[model samples]
Target: MDRSLILGLLIFLTLLAMPFALPLIGQGYLTGLIIKAMLLAIAAISLDLLIGHGGLVSLGHAAFVALGAYAAAIALQSGIENILVLLLITLALTGFVALITGSLALRTTGVYFLMITLAFGQMAYFTLTSLAAYGGDDGLTLWSLATLFGSNVVQKGNGLYFIVLGTLLASWWFVNRMSQSRFGRVLRAARDNPERTEVMGYSVTRYRLVAYVIAAMIAGVSGLLVMQHAEFVSPALAAWQRSGDLIVVVVLGGLATRNGAILGAFFLVIVEELLGSFIHEWRLIYGPLLVFMVLFAKGGLSDLLTSKRRGNQVA
Candidate 1:
């Protein structure tokens, strides 16, 4: 096997063993953190598809996440608690919204596109806050957790952990496949040179719109998972600040690297959790830390690790 395959397998195995090993290491807290990180990683991976592969930077990505979470919460309240059904509803809602917004947003380029997406995301957040039936700004509590085969699988920490892990694995596989597909090639080509792509008879706008919709759908899935794990859905899920955090994750992990997103998610979550445990104002510290990472370690934590590995090999 190639080095990349071997490295991928090793990472997979390590993650697979984490649930079994964490408790023994007295690190059960890390389990929840890891699960949250993995879900965020899934969302980041979706964003990377647009930002990294398609050169489309969206500031409204969290809107899809909010849509998914609210859909799941509403579905559970309406006596439709099946995870699969919730996911489908979430995907449909997010994709439809993406389709509408993307058509308009893609009309502009660069900074204008960013601002438009940001505006839409804030609009979604405000709309959710006005949803009195679902608790408005306070958000709604999910009275029941998601079920599989009539069993509350999500109630068990390990079970929910595995569910998130499975979803992350599947998402990573799908993105890897997508990056190598003909559509992916076209998207990359367009990113490199949109005018050339347009000259070759591919509508750059159409390709970007499709990618945007797909990314929203994937982020919607992350939102569903988040709601299931937290047993709550709120307007905060779609906050513009939340979108910024998603962007930070993408950039921290390194654009276009799938594993980079996963690593970035874990690193950010763990740092927050660990630091927040001791300091209530941990973000005060984290803010500068992130700035340092961006300024000094532009390639991200994954790149740092790879560089260290190469150094050791040389030594």
Candidate 2:
């Protein structure tokens, strides 16, 4: 087996152990934090599939996340109880929206693509705010969460944590597998030279659209999990700021690298939590920290971990 696969396996093992280990140390609350990070990682990994490999920088990815949450929340609010059914609803809504918006967004590239996605995302945000029945700007509180075949396991506690961790791991593996496939190679080719790829008879737009839909669907799943974990969601979940944060996580984790977004999510969340505990204006410190990392750490947090190993190999 490849060394990277071995490394990934070890990391998953550590994550699996944390739920059991953290409580013994009286830091069970950290499990929730881990769940949060994992949720973020799920979304980030999807975004990475777009920006890192497909070279499509979007500013509306979070719209899918919100759509997922809203779809599931509204379904449950209307008496839908089964987690499986809710997931199907969330995927359908998000996928449909992604298909429409991606078709329009794909008409542009580079900064224009970024702007168009932001526009679509804002459209989603405004639409969410208009749903007064769902609490509008105040957000909707899910009075009852989804259940797994009459089991509340996925709705709270360690069950929720493991579910999220499993999802994150699955996402990591899925995206990684896709990135190594022939389709991934073509996507990267389109990213590097579209005209050349078109000359080769590949439909660049089609490839990108598929990638967009895949990413959006993954993000939508993340949103559903987020809603279950928090039990509340607002239109703010679809905002451009949330999209920006996803971008930050992907970039800070290391574009096109396995485990980068996961590491970035954990790092960002832990830093935010630690800083917020000491000061109310942690954002005052946060911006510069990101700036420093972008300027100094070319490959983000993932590189910091493997740089030594790479160096020894080169030597």
Candidate 3:
């Protein structure tokens, strides 16, 4: 078997067995932590599509997460308890917002694009904070969460965990496929040389805008899942800090690598949990790790798992 396939199978098996195996070792509580990591992975994967393939640095990505959460929460508050409906609403809103914001943000490149994204993210945060009816700055605690055919399976137990895992896998696969597609090639062309791509008859901004909307929709799905898991929605979900973390995850994993975001997200969560368990100054340690990775690990942490063990091994 190919080494990559072997590694993938190993990862999939481990994740599938985690819920059952952890309980036998009295580490069942880690399930929630793993779920958190997976959710973050989902969001990070979406951001990766922007930063890696599209060469778009969006500081406002987490705003879609917040929007998705708030949209679901508010819908539940207004008596919409169906998960499907909530997901659709979340996608539509996030996609529409991304279209508008991306169209405007794509007007610039490099630092300007980054700054505009930050501005849009802050605008989303303030907007969420001002929603007095939905708990304002305090956030809204969900009394009722979305359900699949009125079943509570998705609300707790092993169901939500598996669903999230599936979503993570789907996101990884989707992004990988998209990255190899012709559209992704055009995006890459634009990213490498916009003027050249434009001269070749491609609309750089349009391609970027599409990528932005797709990323937002995926992030929104992550947001909805987050709200479901937390049973709460807050403006904090869309905070600029959260957006920064997503970027860190993408970079920490590996840019333009298929599994980079997943690897990065899991590594980050584990490190934080491990360090925070021992030291109160966990974030202080976080900075050094990034520096170390940047200094020593050229392809980011993903390469650690992905690269062949032997130098002569052909992948």
Give TM per candidate. 0.93, 0.96, 0.95
Q: Comparing 2 and 3 by TM-score, which wins?
A: 2
Q: Highest lDDT, which number?
A: 2
lDDT of each: 0.84, 0.90, 0.87
Please list the residue runs of candidate 3 whose C-alpha ends up more than 4 Å from where it truly belongs after superposition: 1-5, 308-315
Report the number of clashing residue pairs per model: 0, 0, 0
Q: 1-315 in candidate 1: lDDT tens per residue?
A: 545445556777888999989899898777887888898999998998888788777898999899988887888889997788888898899899999999999999877888999999999999999999999999999778888868887656889999888989888889878977988989888888889999999998998899999999999999999998888889999998888998888878767764767877878788888899999999999999988987797776666655433210100
Question: What's model 3's TM-score?
Answer: 0.95
| Candidate closer to the true structure by TM-score (higher is better), 1 or 3 | 3
- Please identify model 1 stretches exceeding 4 Å from their true place: 1-5, 307-315
lDDT of 2 by residue, 216-240 (tens): 9999999999999999999999999
Structure candidate 1, residue pairs in collision: none
For each of the candidates, the C-alpha root-mean-square deviation to the true structure, in angstroms, is 4.0, 3.2, 3.4
